[model samples]
Target: MALKDEKVTLAHGGGGKAMRDLIEEVFTSVFRPDGMEDQARLQAAALADPGARLAFTTDGFVVDPLEFPGGDIGTLAVCGTVNDLAVGGARPLWLSAGFIIEEGLDLALLRRVVASMAAEAEKAGVRIVTGDTKVVGRGMADKLFITTSGIGVIPPGRDLQAANIRPGDVAIVNGVLGDHGAAIMAARGEMALSAEIASDCQGLGHLMEAVLAVAPGLRAARDATRGGVAAVLNEMAAAAGVAIEIDEAALPLRAEVRGLCEILGLDPLYLANEGTLVLFVPEHEVAAALAAMRATEAGQGAVAIGRVVPGEAGRVSMRSAFGGLRIVDMLVGEQLPRIC
Candidate 1:
């Protein structure tokens, strides 16, 4: 209620009382950072460990519809940054958000987005300590775009990387694939298709922690975001200098997602996912890893989808349900743009 305008204007971005009111009422009020300084002065006990390492990552989020079925751009921004750090075996701690908001955007919508960001950060155990906002002319930008940078700590002696994967490693996914993409596509309503799919948008820091607790030898994990599971699998194979073979029957997918892809003539493997991730763990520890993952809310659908093997390096193949093999290559181009 502090902001008097129903829609944002260029004055809101100017360094004046309007801008200050917007920032204080819309953003900082919800984030509640320790101070209003231009930069966040961060300190954490985990960083005090002599052998611990710092992990930093930044990502930008833009989707056709700012709000979606399961999540809006705000939820996507936080979860995406948190998952980026979590997949690298980091304990996410802090984040910075930057907003490029268009004039005429509803003030209520901006408030909702800020609230969503704060809630997700709390759930992911991180703080939004600093942020910047700019309002542009109506046609100069979309309704809103968010860029998030995250900071995390890697415990001493924990070095998870794709190159650490070995031939005997097994691949596991956190949950069903293609739901996010399918949900977005259906939400667009361009094809007259209807289905009850929601974006699996969620933070994976807790799930990663749970798995690492039980399977210390876990190799690496990648969130199937822009390019989906096939993209992650190919990257893992190429980085580890090994071949990956996934069983078609083992891929966890919903029947609605399958039907959507079939109707659109799209391959499900190329579909994007927000909460799904593929990880590699030693064959000996697959059971433990899957159990640990399933115990977490973000990983209940965890399953072994594939295994590493000795073959032509950087090659990935899929075994069909009928017992036939086909190469799964890097996606030549995007199947859906602006998916993340």
Candidate 2:
């Protein structure tokens, strides 16, 4: 007659009275006033824009395997949504989740995913105050899918957008590349390499703080996830009507991830990165951005990768260390199709 702890039934996800009861019994129980004050208030608070002007974005997670080395779908969902706001130069604030679970899914696994999501939200300084869930037949869906909507506030006197890009502006990545894609491939047993390539999945809240602290005026920013750095640059350049020139030697790639990509005939430049950022800023602000970025954990391998040029605004070109040059075209379709 009642749902038990560690066991979730269909009633938990239903829109009926049972769902409301579950929300009060468990969700509220974790974030009452007795807990961490700020986090507690966040957990129990309703959706309200913290800033006069807000930037909102939503993202969905359906990474194959759902669980990976550095993170799971839960954390990925939170990180992806928040990163969207952060790279847009906004201070991420709130998140709303919508879950769709396959029938016959393990109750324990679902709980694990939510727990991880809660922990991630706490770390990112965002709250998951509103959400809905549904169940479908086992074969009709993946084990579980999470969709998150994020809201954030942009700081004052600091205007950042794709249109702000200009020729001579430099591009810099917060850290290493291809870790997330490589990690997922390794998890799926897609390649055999001597080294381990765990996903670079992580939160960039602190990293964002560091960059803005020094280079407060940024032109534009984008977190290189599905399309990697190359595609992201192309998007920004095209949107801003500028050509992007990146130094192949400057794009930081971890040896382990690179080795795996090489062995598998994959280009590291096109691989996804969950915890990296591609920033385009004025040439004068480049050093400051680099300094600020390297100040955070997520930006340990920060490097100045490229610059904007006048022609072929939407095209990306890579310059070899030895002086050769080649065009870096966007992927026809998704490289790692299901990568979050």
- Candidates in order, TM-scores: namely 0.99, 0.88
lDDT tens readout by residue for model 2, 1-340: 2445455556666777766665555455432224423322342232342434577999889998788889889889989998999888778888877888776677667767777888988998887766766767658788888899988777655577899988899998888899999888888865554466678888887788778888766788888898788788878978998888889888788888878887778888889888888888789988888888777778878888889876765888989999998999887776676888
* Best candidate, TM-score: 1
* Worst-scoring 10-residue span by lDDT in model 2: 36-45
Per-residue lDDT tens digits for candidate 1, residues 1-340, read 6689999999999989999999999999999999999999999999999999999999999887888899989999999999999999999999999999999999999999899999999999999999999899978998999999999999998898899999989999999999889889988888898788999999999999999999999999999998899999999899999999999999999999999998889999989999999999998899999999999999999999999987899999999999999999989978887878
Please report how far candidate 1 places residue 20 from its true position, in Å. Answer: 0.6
* Model 1, position 128: C-alpha lDDT score: 98
Off by over 4 Å in 1: none
lDDT of each: 0.93, 0.79
**Per-residue error (Å), model 1, residue 138:** 1.6
User: Each candidate's root-mean-square deviation in Å?
Assistant: 0.7, 4.0
Candidate 2, which segments miss by more than 4 Å at Cα? 5-51, 190-194
Clashing pairs in 2: 242-313
lDDT of 2 at 86: 88
